[model samples]
Target: MKPQRRLRLGMVGGGEGAFIGAVHRLAARMDDRYELVAGAFSSSLENCQRTGAALWLDPARCYASYQKMAAQEADGIDVVAIVTPNFLHAPVATAFLQAGIHVICDKPLCLNAQQASQLAAVVKQSQCQFILTHNYSAYPLIREARQRVLSGELGEIRFVEVEYLQDWMSELVEQTDNKQASWRGEPAKAGAGCIGDVGTHAWQLASFVSGMLPQSLSAELATVVAGRALDDDVRVTLRYANGARGRLWASQVASGHENSLRLRIYGSEASLEFQQENPNQLWIRPRNAPAYCLTRGSGVLSDEVRTMGRVPAGHPEGYLEGFGQIYREAADQIWAAIDGQPFSGSLLPGIDDGVAGMKFIDAVRHSSMADGKWVDFSAA
Candidate 1:
């Protein structure tokens, strides 16, 4: 296949001081797969201008709202990266998808399942590529874990445990003009707060590695912080249709923990573990055997996992590189779409994944409200 021109990418959010916005930008540019051409960086025009100027975007292309950006760039931009708050995700993604532009949006899909369903419809009707930025799924070791699990290296998966913990919201940071925390803590703006934020990532990571979806769930969602509206902590049990069980625990008030996302999957024959903080190494333990560490960029890595690593073994490739992998995969799909060719083997999360995430979130909330009843996950 002939190499296509670099993808023309636009942004709907990620203005100044928004952590994930900068992350999306860096990820998009990391592999040279995309060029940021346009953006409505923030709701405030002044902030948008500042962000546009900082990103070296043409002033005329940075609009005041996502609607204008979508309408005006419909013919020019090939992809729109939606990095706004959770509530804006559905609307912004819908507009871009309707405009026939592919989308690379931040995760948790939308504010709720209804919005997720609506956005899923838009994506289906438009037939546009929609890539949800579940960056953790892009890690090379995580890909290795998925491949190993699929190849039966770990035998029958019996138990899975995943946790994502952070201490940023342990205190009432939302009350101190912390823009990220402010919107994130608000139910209207962030949907389910910690659950929607990092919890969704945990959910996606678990499903991605184990290749199993929860059939039923019992959840306890709590607001650890006194003044917080939405959940700051969550603990959920997952029952898989295949009789495999799992547990997920996510918290923003886990004091002293910062970005401590970890996954442990145990099978009848073996087990595998991976941690986000030490992303370069994956642990594998066979039945009655000592644990062994597998490092990235090693010759032992499978071809698929090897391709995801940019540097050699000792040099670390963490969050940004993992994020870039997702962008590269999305770029491949986008080019395939443009060239009218068959697209295959893409691991990037799409609209269906987004909807499922919303449903998982809804199930958690409902189960919590119902006193931790075993809620049917399919019904979510």
Candidate 2:
């Protein structure tokens, strides 16, 4: 097969000081798979023009609105990357997908499950790919963990514990005009603060590792910051189909912690633990044997894990690398779809996962608001 060409991409947001936009660009460029040809960087036209200049995009192609960009870039661009706030994800993605372009969207797919379902329907009708950037699932070690659980290496899973904690919003940073914090704390912009922000990551990671969706969930949400509209901390207890139990805690109010995401799964025969801070190692303990440490590129890794591990042993592959893997896989699928060829491999998280995340978010919020009563996640 001939090598596929780079994708022509456009961005919906991620203007000045935007966090995830630059990361998306870096991940796209890391493997030479996508070229950001245009963008509607911000709501402000001036900021959009400035960002377009900085990105060296053509003036005519730089748009001030996603609707205009989608209509115009439909014939030119191959894909659109939506890096906007939570509320904008569904509209932007729907526009691009309706325009017959592939989409690479950030997580917490939309403001709610209703919008997620609408976008999912569009993705199904359009022949374009919709890749969600739940990048942690692309980590080599994470792939290994998923394989172990799926292959019954850990026997029948009985418990799952996952937590994602950060201290960036420990105080009222939004009151001080912090751009990231300002929009994120606003319910209109971010949808659900830390729960929608990081809790989605926790939920996705757990489901990714276990290959099981929660049947029901009971949750508690708290806004520690005075006058904040959304929850800054969330605790959820999940019930799985096979009678397995899980607990998830996601918080931005954990003082002194910075992006601390950890997961542990226990089964009848063995257990596994993975820490995001230490991405390269996986701890495994058998019921009657000594605990073992497995590194990313070790001999114990499966073929699937080794395929995702690009660098040699001892080399650290962090967030950007994992994100890059997702982009690479998406690029492959996009190219295959474009060329009408077979692409016979998984492409990390996609639109289905996005729908699942949004449903999970809705269930969490409903469960919390109902005084921690069990809410059926599958109903969403």
Candidate 3:
């Protein structure tokens, strides 16, 4: 198939001071698969205009609200990236999808199951693709780990552990001028603090690599920071359908840690570990053999997996590159669907993955509220 032009992109939120929005912009452009064309960058018109001017976007294309952007740019851009707060995720996505635009949304899907149901319905009725940015799963070694497990290298899975820790909110940062912290520390905006923020990422990573969603879970959710309105620390025990058990921990108040997302999977025959801070290596411990490390650039990776990186091994691609892989995959999938051609298969996260994350979150919240009782995933 002949190569096509870059997908024209638009964004909502991530205006002047947002962090993740800039990350999304960098990642989307890293693989040269997308070109941002417009955005409703902020609720404030001045901020939107300033952001658009900085990006060299047409001043007219920078709308004051997402609803206006969705209406006017509906046919102008190929896809819209949703980088708004958690509470706005569902509605923003719904508007774009209803306008027949594809979407690349940030994680935790939405605030709760009710929003999930509404967005799920919109996704089903739309013809456009939906890509959720579970960027961790798109890492090179992480993809290899998923392949290895799916190919039976792990035997029957027995244990899974995922812990995502950060210390950015160790104090009452929300009480200050921290823009990200202000909304994130609120239940209305962030939904569930560390659980919705990082716990879902951990859960998604476990399920992505291990290919197992728990049957039920017992959880303890706590607001580790004093005077905080939302839970910042969480521990959950997972029970898989095959009797395999798992543990997940996410905390924004974990001191001396920054983006310390890590995972370990133990099966009948061996165990594997991956740490985000390292990003370039995976450690495998076999039952009978000495454990060894798997690096990102190793020849062990398939041709397809290696394409995720812009440079060769030892160049050290981390968070940004992992996120770029998602954008690249979304571009490929969307182009394939448009061209009526069979293209490379994808493991891109979609609406179902988003819904699963929501349900897991709901169950965890329920279990924690019910005195750490086991809450079935089915009821979520």
lDDT of each: 0.91, 0.89, 0.91
Clashing pairs in 1: none
Q: Distance from true position, residue 269, model 1, in Å?
A: 0.6
Considering TM-score, which of the candidate structures 2 and 3 is the better prediction for this target? 3
Q: Report the C-alpha lDDT of model 1 over 1-380, residue by residue, as the tens digit.
A: 64567899999888888888898888889888899999998889999999999888899999988899889999989999988888888888888889999999988889889888988889999989999989999999999999999999999889989999999999999888898888887788888888999999999999999999989999999988787788899999999987899999999999999999999999988999999999999999999888899999668989978877888779988999988898988999999998888998888999889999999999999999999999999988
Which residue runs of candidate 2 sit more than 4 Å off their true CA positions?
none
Root-mean-square deviation of Cα positions for candidate 3 versus the true structure, in angstroms: 1.2
Write down the lDDT that model 3 would get: 0.91
Please report, as a residue range, the 10-residue window in candidate 1 with the lowest summed lDDT.
1-10
Deviation of model 2 at 95, angstroms: 1.0
Q: What TM-score, computed on C-alpha atoms, does each candidate reach? A: 0.98, 0.97, 0.98
Clashing pairs in 2: none
Q: Total clashes, candidate 2?
A: 0
Going through the candidates in the order shown, the clash numbers are 0, 0, 0
**Local distance difference test, candidate 1:** 0.91
Can you tell me which runs of candidate 3 are displaced by over 4 Å?
Answer: 342-344
Can you rank all candidates by TM-score, best first? 1, 3, 2
Per-residue lDDT of 308 in model 1: 78
